[model samples]
Target chain A: MRLSYPANVKIILVPCTGKVDVMHLLQAIQRGADGVYCVGCLEGTCHYNQGNLRCRERVERVREILQEIGLEPDRVRMYNLSSGEAPTFVAYAREMTELIRRLGPNPLKHSKPSIRLEEAA
Target chain B: MIVAKRKPFEEILQMIAGHRKVLIAGCGTCVAVCLAGGEKEVAVLAAEIDMARRLKNQPIELGQTTLERQCDREYLAQLDDRAASYEAIVSLACGVGIQFLAERFPTIPVYPGVDTCGLAVNQDVGWYEERCRSCGRCVLDRTGGICPVTLCAKGLYNGPCGGTNRGFCEIDPEQPCAWYAIYERLKGQGRLERIRAITPVQEWRDTVPRTLLQPGYRKPEKAKS
Candidate 1:
């Protein structure tokens, strides 16, 4: 059987994970993802010399924000994996799926009003 | 250019603690140039607040949006409708943007996420220093065009006072005395004689309680209708 991940976990494929801006990372959280992770080229191996570095910085910054917002910073994570790193990719997927599973369903799922209420309180 | 720095995220969070619905507004101008308040900043703030609320199970409705220029009413008009939805607004723009947001969203409380420091020019990437004070009355035509309001430390309009030492300022050893530089610059230009003319004290109103005006940006009567 082909290995698949949790149906609820949405994987976004970016050309280079380094291209992810801090806002985009935050936007993922705002859009109601249970957990978000990025897979990018290893340090110093990015297609763009420092794109991965920049993306890593963004991820780290988001982690700090998550903590301030009273969430576990672990909710958003970044990993360095070249295109050929299939095992690493699958491992990351599994890890994120497990984390999301523990986090349970997204608070905003199918309930905009309730999400807003929850957010307001 | 205005120089500013991001207030610590925690400080910002504390400022908007009571508001259930919040908007993070970024200025696309001066603060953006410094990488403090811009679209990226607004997004980061919104996300941080969201995550914080989620973790606490307190949940705060947060929105992210940016304006091209916070000082211009034309650009600020964009926030009109959305401003009503949020209980409070956090501005990442310079002091101007924060004030503009307040003016536009009078009913909704507006907060600043960055401290608007004095006017400055980038000394290098990620570095900036005080430059202009926009003192309304400009005297750059004389004194070799250097601004005294920001540079002189004393805002002196005359020759270097007794405090200057070896052409450096007493206030800061790294800074060359403003009048000393002005003297040298004007002497080289053969305009040193102009220093004898005392400039009237710069009016205080021009430099503070800052105001912004955008010509011809008001919606026409037809548009308003």
Candidate 2:
């Protein structure tokens, strides 16, 4: 299983993708992550039953929240893959990296000047 | 529980627009259970609003607090002095809590952050279905614990209306007709005869803004004897 994906793509493993709360994705974005994506077991094939399904719902909800706040909803996503599908995982990583590259850095990271001025005022 | 939903983000922003500082008051009881105005939701909303405002160059001074039960005067009193610092308060409580806050804080303008839906039962995670309308009359005994007032689209007491087709509601094909459910439940309990007993016209007087003085509390004038 020696697969080469984007070196810049960092991964944070979770017990189950269902354990991925909305706050986790949001905090990642707030902490200057250009993009965040959850890779869970394939739909209906979750080890803890509907863990992947629940993660999908949470991703959609976070997407909606992002859209409401004028952020690029595409910056976050949920992907399904089984343990054997290493190729698919690499493909998803590449796809997400490309999407984020096109979208540029998260606006929050660049908007510090106005925020600093606001605090100073 | 009294279910509620957050008002649209845009609408909420509009409410506190001109104000530079505001407090988000969350209710920890019913609205929390409904996932609308709990402590976690308050934090999420605060972060969202803060981010949105910062993006627009109109950063707001936002504070957050959650009351054990917003409807109770004692719980609301906790914010007595602290709430004075903010220009306005955005209450993430049900309608009752919003009104209660206004009453308790006569000088402060308290805005509603959530819309009180109705009495609801959790259908599943993130899904709630209205179960009762609090119509002031209990008909669960006759309806076999199925509430037609809230479940039926038309709120018909003597029902299984003409719109019912093969036990499904005409309004939504996916939903079972409330009266059909009532009939099945009664049949299962061997209480089908209860449905036949003509229910009198519901007293509309009780439906108005009514208050019940708890028996142990101050007795009403009529009950003074």
Candidate 3:
């Protein structure tokens, strides 16, 4: 019998988390991400005084843009994890994987059904 | 500085739907100082548009350029060599600059990316509020520096509205009641008594029908022998 491994998800890593620009976040959603989140240092402990805070603002703006485009804002998220928190990383992946399982494919994919105005209305 | 904000991404996408080549023009003037339509914004907008086009499988070429001053002929002339190459030009300048580009490049269509918000004062980073309407009148001497016509929300020239609560405007809780600010300024300068007299209704006709004039020029006359 052949052994099989569970499907894995990809998480983009950034420096200080604040470096993640709003355009990058919007592009990720536009390019079709199952679930996206920014993992940074704890609120006050950010290497940069407020890099995490900046990332939080960008995430909020991205959420607004998603809502404007009729997409679910909940699909995007933000979180923080310290370097030693390997378990926390695993938990995040698990949580995202489960959410992805329920969410299915990304709405931005051309293969998926397009958003209809009348139906949405 | 002339503060402005870009239209929504979808709105911009719709504006240049069928155009293949887009020239993103940025003005290094009031728009730049306000962090609105500067060079950085031009590049970001171009990238976003390009990404949107590629995502939809409709690839388009976007050329980005910034002018020292879009309203001046010297800055606009810098694009003479390459201006005709693009199908459309997206101007990230004030309304005046956008029209200037259109006049200089009559063959190409120019689309305004930013909505001319209003004359504003930057409170701080990422915070700006409209401060003046520039109704072509100057009455600040009597009313103190605070502009009652613009900042008051209701444009009341006399004093705070009845709805004012604890120095904030009723219209927007975040905004300071313009008339109240004016009153305080007058009190500080001992000009409170001077402003007690009501100001008359301003001639609003000057604010209507926008007009543009070329600098240092006069209409040519049709001469006869």
Reference-based lDDT, each prediction? 0.76, 0.86, 0.77
lDDT of 2 at B123: 92
| Per-candidate TM-score against the hidden true structure | 0.69, 0.85, 0.75
lDDT of 2: 0.86
* Weakest lDDT window of 10 consecutive positions for candidate 1 chain B: B216-225
Q: Which ten residues in a row have the lowest lDDT in candidate 3 chain B?
A: B216-225
Q: What would the per-residue lDDT of candidate 3 be over residues A1-121, giving only the tens digit for each residue?
A: 2323225766566777989987687666666666687888888988789999999998897777666555667677787888777778677767767776787766566532221111100
How many clashing pairs per prediction, in order?
4, 0, 0
Query: What TM-score does prediction 2 earn?
Result: 0.85
- In terms of docking quality, model 2 is incorrect
TM-score-best of 1 and 3: 3
Winner of 2 and 3 under DockQ: 2
* Candidate 1 residue runs with Cα over 4 Å from true position: A1-18, A24-60, A63-67, A70-121, B123-125, B203-225
Name the better of 1 and 3 by lDDT.
Answer: 3
Chain B: TM-scores of all predictions: 0.86, 0.94, 0.88
